[model samples]
Target: MSKIAFIFPGQGAQYVGMGKEIAMEHKSAQDIFEKANESLGFDIKKMCFEGPEEELVKTEYTQPAILTTSIAILSVIQQNGIEADITAGLSLGEYSALVYAGALKFEDAVKLVNKRGKYMQEAVPLGKGNMAAIIGLDRKEVDSIIKEAQDVGTVEGANYNCPGQIVISGEINAVEKACELAKEKGAKKAVLLPVSAPFHCSLLKPAGERLSEKMESLNIGSLQRKVISNVTGDYIANEKDIKDLLIKQVSKSVLWQDSIELMLDGGYDTFIEIGPGKTLTAFTKKTARKLKKKVKCYNVENTKTLNKLLTELG
Candidate 1:
């Protein structure tokens, strides 16, 4: 029998009015938003529903908003009897996965992620660090390009998103140089990402350090379900490992492609992306095609989409 895995997307997936439909239509969803506001001590729902786009995009607000929205949607799905056998998320999404797995409480995850976002945003000065996407380049070639640009600064592969799409992050100069080198190495295209910080790179070490200290003060628990780590592409089974990996994940490359493969290898053929955007679903389809695997992927952003997914899965 095929098992279902619920995945969540990270920072770049958020948009204005992402969770408004659910909050407006479902009491459970509305309760979630209200709880998030209470737990966070602010009106996160307003920022998510009526964002100026710029304010919503701020890292601090973005992380909690996405987490709350995903958990709210998950609440709705669970009410309807749709459950996940395993859970995983990418980067910021990992917090959502932990909350779903019961390793972290929703309220604590919200506060922690808010701090995480703030620390990450403050890690590097504006314009000092950057990120870029190199499309149509194999991992080896992308790695080579990043290595070649290391002399300019500390360029490194950050997000292994799909078979031929990788994101690199580092010093702004190094990232720009890497993009040029990627084009020369026959990448289909290399473009700078519109992000504020060089996430998932060595430049984020300070942020990781801060997060580690903050995490030490929190009460983390054992997971109710399996959760794959983005740092190692492995299932984290212990609380110690979870804390360690979460800290390291800030400056470590996100092995998203490997995590997906690991899940596929473990008998999860259906992946349900429970978040605002279909970004992960799109990437999963590409990866599945490249690996010649017959996996079904779905993205449920609202009740209508959730209903469709349940019907299709049935």
Candidate 2:
């Protein structure tokens, strides 16, 4: 028997007009957007649909907006009787995965992510921190370089995206040092990412601390579908663990590559990325190719993609 996994995309996946088509076509999708707006006490819909891209990209607005849009598209998928055996997400996308798994209420998730984004942004001063992508480097080799660069300043592995692609984050000096060293260490390319803050590094510990305090005030429930955690690359089964993981995730490397491997180990052969952009899909293809496994991956961001996925899956 084949199992399907529903994956959600993170920050870089957001665009000006993401889920507008789904919202206009499906009442379920529209309801998600409406409820998110009411819960967030702002018009996130407008920000997503009519974004002055710069304003929409603010951490506070971007986090909740992307979560809501992903869930809106997810609601449409679920309404059409498409469901997943397991779910996972990247960075901010993890909250969307939790919402789909029934581990969190959509209203609470929107509010929490809004706060999460703010805390994350405020954790480090602008331009003080940086993140970079090191392509064509093995994970172990990149980890070694990150450790070696620590002498210059704080540096840590951020996202283990795929077999040959890893993202590192830390102080600007440290990140630059790592980039220079990475190229010398046989990496094809090591370039700074266009991000305001160094996410998923020790530098973001302050953000994690603030998120922990805020998480205590929310009401989280047990999940119906299995949800993979970014911090552990393992299944989060309880509410307490879920809360702890979300807090830890702020400053810990996202073990996305490991998480996908674990999903495959659990017998999932098909992955459906149900959100905006094809970021996760691109990574999935890379991972599958590296593993020499023929996996089915689909990306459903609009009605056309959704219909095609439904037909293919059927």
Residues 56-80, candidate 2: write the lDDT tens digits. Answer: 8999999999999899999878877
Candidate 1: where are CA atoms >4 Å away? none
TM-score of each: 0.98, 0.98
- The ten-residue window of minimal lDDT in model 2 covers 285-294
TM-score of 1: 0.98
| lDDT of every predicted structure (CA atoms) | 0.91, 0.91
RMSD of each: 1.0, 1.0
What value of lDDT does candidate 2 attain over all alpha carbons?
Answer: 0.91
